[model samples]
Target: MSKRDYYEVLGVAKGASERDIKKAYKKLAMKYHPDRAQGDKSLEEKFREVQEAYEILSDERKRAAYDQYGHAGVDPNRGGGAGAADFGDIFGDVFGDIFGGGRGRQSRARQGSDLRYNLEMSLEEAVRGKEVEIRVPTLVECDTCHGSGAKKGSSPTTCPTCKGNGQVQMRQGFFAVQQTCPTCSGKGKIISDPCNPCRGQGRVEKTKTLSVKVPPGVDTGDRIRLSGEGEAGEQGAPAGDLYVQVHVRDHHIFTRDGNNLYCEVPLGFTTAALGGEIEVPTLDGKVKLKITPETQTGKMFRLRGKGVKSVRSGAVGDLMCKVEIETPVNLSSKQKELLEEFEATCTGQGAKHRPKEKGFFDGVKQFFDDLKS
Candidate 1:
């Protein structure tokens, strides 16, 4: 029986690109696969036919020869025993993901994983910056074997089972299954005389002391990176980095937002009623803030350049001090009498000195009148 055209079997035009042919074959393969269409002989035969069609049409040279002289030109039975080119193309498409059996061997020397250390700092320390010492547990190179995993004079030997391939393949019913070598566990070598210090591993677990310089104006959530301070990799691979994550402690006197500092300053009634200068605390030192006459509670005063300078940029921010007027407590009888006399004199002025209180009373009266109506 004459064979069908390869392109027509795969349902692709002769001028179709390699990608188009692969796409059409993949759809047919998925649809007619024996696993998907169980016990269906017709579908299984269709799957094999599509696979054979793709095997010929997907190759440039074989496709050209077949296009010129038909199937007889490139047939394996025609004295040209299955071409090396055709075998490689089929194997690559089928089993490329199996073990280290691909084109190149996988790299043995892998870098270590990055580590994070939470560091809590006082607000003052975070704002001013300081050198902090942190102890981190990490893997360091073994002193005895110097990261070779071998004894003083001896070294590791190639695995007897896999012969340094680092992988072993097993034939499983029409498919080759590749897995890590059981003897070497994929290392491809075995150490006969292991180091006593690190025991067959090239690294030792120990606490490492690192000095990290915290930059000025670093707020919470800022991280400082210390290069090559993390765990050491196996067989002299490159070490990972150490990240110091900052956490600023709550301050009793101040709260910070970005570069700005905010604080509440309590003032006596006399200082709020009759203007006075009071001392306010800043990161640098104490600064005097002037309060004008009749200063009310919740009044804010800004002192320029008294806040922290940003670490990202050197721009300084202002300190905002909010005033909270303190009423007199523990008053004597004489003080109470004197306050009453002063209140009486103020009442005689008829709400002129207390415009806010007078407006509040006016609103209250209007509300009651509207309710009665």
Candidate 2:
């Protein structure tokens, strides 16, 4: 079969720039890659064709020779072109861009993993702030070898298979494929004499005591970051961060929304009707809340500066107290007779004493009379 033009195979112009040619070949390679095309033999053949075209066109020397003498000039079968190693290196770069896997030496120093600690606090503690000590079990640098992963005097050696590159390249038809070195597991180095305390991991599990300062007004779901407090990195690299997740325990008296606090306060029937002052609890201390005369149930009273101050700002919120009137119960015989005598005085004063009840009964009577008519 006759071979197609290098430019035509990549769907690029004959005089296209190197960048344009690379972009065209990348699109074709990603589309016709064997892994992407499954087991289709025809697409695999097309992929090889695209790879061959890119190999010749991407190189200045090979491209010039091919332009002068056509396929005969750069054909490997004809023994007129660059060596197989040269093509492998070229395709390695192209494949590296398509996949994140690179052709260069990989770093062996791995960063530690970040950790989260859920810290529960009482409502009073959260509002007022406190500093407490926490015990965490995590990986720390091994003291025996000083986190080197090798014995006291010994050190890690470069991988012989990959020459410390952490990767190996293989020639597949007209393309070069790069993969992690199997011998050293892509670590680039091997620890022959493992550390006694941490085996070869360079870290050991231990419980660490850390002091965390809880900021004022930090509610549930808030986080405080403590840098370098997480798991120790491998082989003495920088440690990861520790996140302190705040979780406020449920309060018995108040419910917090943002910086504002809400609570229900029960009022005696006489105290609500006659008006009086009652004590309410706040994070600072107890304060007097004055109730107005003729106050009904579900009346809300706002106390300024009684709620939490914002952690991020200086603004203070108010406390909203909802009052519910409590009716007296379990009365004695004399008390019941006194309440009956009081009710008899109020019996003919429904419009004055119980206007809401009178209006409701009047609405019910009007509805029934209209239904009958």
Candidate 3:
């Protein structure tokens, strides 16, 4: 008898995907299986033909040979097809795909989740670095059961439902499928006597205090990672990590931009007119700031190497100070008279001493003259 084409027997196209071939084979196998056929000889013969077709077509080497030479390429009678052991391997793979495992298989364990903690630090502490303690509430491994979830002097036993396989196979109509054991919950073990503290959970919620060392020049949004400091894993698995997020508090004296520091320095009126050395505050200490004669308000002075030194690159930044001249207030009668006489002498000198004030009045006079015209 001439054998039919494998694709024709399976009722699938020659260019069909592996998945399509498997699907067609499964449907035909279900219809012609000997158990479903109930001892009918013809149906049993058809079942054998279907099995043979699947065995040859499912194998890459055999399928390739069969595609080129037809039935002569894979003749089971001529010892060219798969042997009994090879057939067993094929059956194992197909059955495993349909009804899951038949041998020993380990269940997957869960790992702990990572955690985050926000840390607030003062400007001085952020620039200089400091060690701080933080309290975190998380799950910790139970000591009574040693993370086994079993009571003292007791241990977990193999689940009778799955027989320690952690999975159970069920026959459904024409297909068999495997699922996690309901009784064991896929753990493959049963804890009859649970621990008193964790009550079979193997872990407990507790608050832990840990010390975190903040590095110098750590800006806001910087994170310090601490390994194995997060929540405890299930059944003594590996612990997760803890990330400490840094947040620097605002400074009252200076505003920091990257590594540079900016501040407003109040300059006395006499100092602005006559010019002299004034003391200015820096991160290191006070520095003498020399003011030029007739220095105007809002004049900026740059003091190099007086700002923050970068922790990453170790580069020094400058401190920029803006001068704001303060006007005299609460003058006595004699002081006011002396100021009026000094002002009169200064105005008599024209725009020599007060060029800015003279320019402002000159612009106003031009504006009125233009409006009259």
Query: What TM-score would each prediction reach against the true structure?
Result: 0.68, 0.71, 0.62
Q: In candidate 3, which residue pairs get closer than 3 Å at backbone N, Cα or C atoms, i.e. clash?
A: none
Against the unseen true structure, what C-alpha lDDT does each candidate score?
A: 0.79, 0.83, 0.78
- Each candidate's number of clashing pairs is 0, 0, 0
Model 2 clash count equals 0
lDDT of 3 by residue, 247-319 (tens): 6666789877767889999999999999999999987789999999889999999999887777789887899
lDDT of 2 by residue, 204-291 (tens): 9999999999989987656688998988887887787787866677789998877899999999988998999999887778899999
lDDT of 1 by residue, 1-373 (tens): 7888888998988889876886687567657766666899999889778866776776677787677667865674432223555556446534864544554233254566556787888889999999989999989988888888888899989888878777776667667656668998867788999988899888999998888999999876566888888778776677877878676766899988778999999999888989989999998889899999999999999999989999988999899999999999999999999999989889756578888988898899999999999
Q: Report lDDT (Cα) of residue 316, candidate 1.
A: 92
Where is the poorest 10-residue window by lDDT in model 3? 77-86
Better of 1 and 2 by lDDT: 2
RMSD (Cα, Å) of model 2: 19.8
Q: Which residue ranges in model 2 land beyond 4 Å of their true spot?
A: 1-94, 97-105, 366-373
lDDT leaderboard ranking: 2, 1, 3
Best by TM-score: 2
